[model samples]
Every structure is written in C-alpha cells, then in structure tokens.
Target: MYQHEPPTEESPKEYKIKHARIYILLLIGQVLFPNKSGNTIHSKWTQFVVDLEDCGKLSWGFTVLANLYREMCKSVDIKVTEMSGCVLLLQAWAFTRMPIISLVAPLQAPYPYARRWCIKKLDYQNNPRHHLQGYRFRIDHMLQDQFIWRPYLGLAPQRHEDSLIWSSTTYIICFHIVEMHQADRVKLQFGHLQGIPEEPQCLVEHHKMTTIKARQKAYTTLYSDEQNCWLHRELFMLDGD
Candidate 1:
C-alpha cells in the first residue's frame, strides 16, 4: 500500500530561484505592486488569497493545522495538530535552516481519537521571527527574548483530532517568512555573521567548520528548550481548509 522512491536528482537552489522568482513577479508584484495599477483580478493566486483572507471559508488553502481551535470551538477535549498542509516540505535542519513553509503531506487528525500531540522537536528548533534576528543561515538561530533565547520561528509539531484529510488546490500559496533586509547576497553570506550586532555586548563568534563541536558546546546553553520554545505548547498553528 506504500512505497518509496529515491530522487533522481536534487538541485534545490535552482528550483527555488525559479519557483520563488516567478511567484513574486506574477502573484505578488503583479497584483500588489505599490505603483502599478491593475484593476482586474489578473492573477488567480491573489484572488484566492483575498478570498481566503476575507471569506474565512475553506475555499482557499491546502494547509495542515493543529486541532486546538476546532476542539475549543466544539467544546471537545482535544490536543493540537502541527505540521499540516502544502506539498514541498522544507527540512531546514539539513539545509540553510531557513524558516520557510516547505511542504509536506497535510498532517491530519487520526480516526477514533480525541487528540494527540506528536510533532515536537522539529517545532521547537525553528524559531519564528528569527528572520528579524537575521539567522536563516545560522544552524543555531536562537534569539534573545528579554532574558531568554527563543527559536527564531518555533516549529513545534501540533496535536490534532480524529478526523482530517488532505484536499487538493489548483495551487498552494505559502508565505515565506524569510527575506533579506540586507541586500547584496554576498554580504549576507554565512561568513559575515561574525559582524552581527550583539545586545548584551558579550556575545562572541567562533570560526565554523564542518563540525564545530566547540562552537556548538559554547552556544548550546544560549537557548532554553523549556522556556522560550518557538512553538506554543498550548496553541499550535491552526491552518484550515
């Protein structure tokens, strides 16, 4: 009933450049350009986003979500559902650790169950809003939050109910949370991270390597898994149909 197929080739950089560029030009730039004037619904993707944003119905997205909201609305005791929706899965753990909504099979609620919270580790490590802190390239993107370090964009797995399924869309619109505030890609490369400003004026940098054991050991304590997780234990992302 199930099967696996190894990839014939993988060139993520090429794919992302093409895919991301086209999307910006067509969907966002065409429709929401600051100065450009388009009176009609030139792009279907824009229309869908508006419809979803306004209609608040299940007519827009192909997203996976936690069950907390639905359960709360129904007054049913249930856990949240994490990691649902989209087809392109971004396991940033292996890549640049960019907090993009890489797709995966829509995480769904199982049958005959009230709730279960399963997705955990992946959620905690990817801190949300770290793009502001400027660490899409840093393996450890923990940021100082008041007195604690939080995952740049917390990516904890969510809990869910016993009934959910995946439906197709003409296209899925995923909002990438990472964009360069600093232009000149060369300046933003991994090498320049050393010059990043520090808050308490004590943070230092170590030369990275294929295996930066000493560096990691030093930085590991910078974050707290218990206190400043990126994902909320009680409220998971409740993406809808």
Candidate 2:
C-alpha cells in the first residue's frame, strides 16, 4: 500500500530544478566511482546521495536489470551499457528485489528502458569522451527518500524526470517511494553488488517482459495525471532568460 501526496496549489514550479541539481550530483558520483573501475571499491556515503529520495535506492537494481531485459527485447530502442552498472544492479536485485524503478512515486514518467538517459548539452571541452558523446557510464545509488520534482528547467536534456509529458511546465517531485519491501531487496541482489550478501543469485537474465512493460505503463498513468493538470492550470515556468 503506497501513499502519494498530489501537488497542492501553493506548490511552486521550481521543485523540478532542485531535483535536477540533486540528480546531477548523484550521476557525477556514479561516473567518478563506478564499481571496481574507480578509486574506492565501495562507499556507503556515495551510495546514499545518489537517489537522495530513496528509489532513489534498491530501485536502481530494478532499473539495471529492467534495462538489461529491455535492451534484449526487439521493441525496446535504447540500450544500457555493459559494465559494472549493470553488474552492480544484478547484485542488488538478487538480494533486494527493489529495483530503483519502485522507489519513485508510481507517477514518474517511466524510464525508457530502450533509450539512454536524457540530457541537454555538454561541456565536452572539460568533459571526457563518454559524457561528451552522450554516455552516462556511472551512477550513484541511495536507499532514502529526499527528492521531489521541480519544473523550472525546460525540457532540456538534463531535466530527466518525465519530460515527454511535462513539456516545460511545472516540475514538482510527483512521487516519493521510501518504504521498503521484498522487490526492493531483490533488485539489489540481482545486481550482485550487495555489500554484506557474500553470494549471488544470478537471476538477472530471467525476468518476463510483462513485468517490465507493466512498470512502464504504471509510470505513464501517473505521469499523465500530472501532465493533464499542468495543461489545465497552464502553470508553466516563466524564466527571464
């Protein structure tokens, strides 16, 4: 049983931007300290801030595995890379069953399993080949609930919430999924990245596409609800730039 609080009239349209700032910090950490390839083998602090909002946690496991499965499907167009991100995800799902997908309120625009992460521009002059070329090879993950959507930044690439529907309207953190359960833990185990769990389940290769599609459809319903409200209210951001 989940409980979501819809946006109130008083809620401003800047929350999405705030969420984007948090996401940027987390994504940076993932790239800098990816599994086995980076400086530190593991860091709890690094993990916590990744999702800040908690699905912001084991939900990533879901994302990794779901992504892996999604890529294999013929209908899915995007692709997740072959690296520790996927490996870590398998580890997490094996033990937790909590895919990052389950962390946000069911209202998020479901991540396109086939497509790569969304983005806007790049500072390639200072960045590496991966980001400059549209590759987010790293990610920071957390097991908390500290994020909400803000809709100030237009549908630029970096604004990774549910852009298709949000358009450039208000960006409020529409969903918050903090409570825990079996699925959450499973996603972590699936990733085989569990810190204490010593063993692996190796079940990442066996999920049904229906589960993946179900999650996506669910996300759509939730996102649509907000998008419709945005259209009616006409509460889009009004930047001076």
Task: Give each model's whole-structure lDDT.
Answer: 0.28, 0.35
Residue-level lDDT tens digits of model 1 in 1-241:
1132322347565554444444444433332321123332334344444332353553222221211112122342256333222112223222223324221222433531211123332343334333634334343543433111122223333522211222111111112111111111222222222243333211122111113353454323433342232223223222231
Query: Which residue runs of candidate 2 sit more than 4 Å off their true CA positions?
Result: 1-51, 54-58, 74-218, 222-241
| Model 2 residue 207 CA deviation in Å | 14
Query: Which candidate comes out best when scored by TM-score?
Result: 2
Off by more than 4 A, model 1: 1-42, 51-55, 59-159, 166-241
> What is the Cα-based lDDT of residue 87 in candidate 2?
39
Q: What is the TM-score of each candidate against the true structure?
A: 0.16, 0.19
Would you give me the overall lDDT of model 2? Answer: 0.35
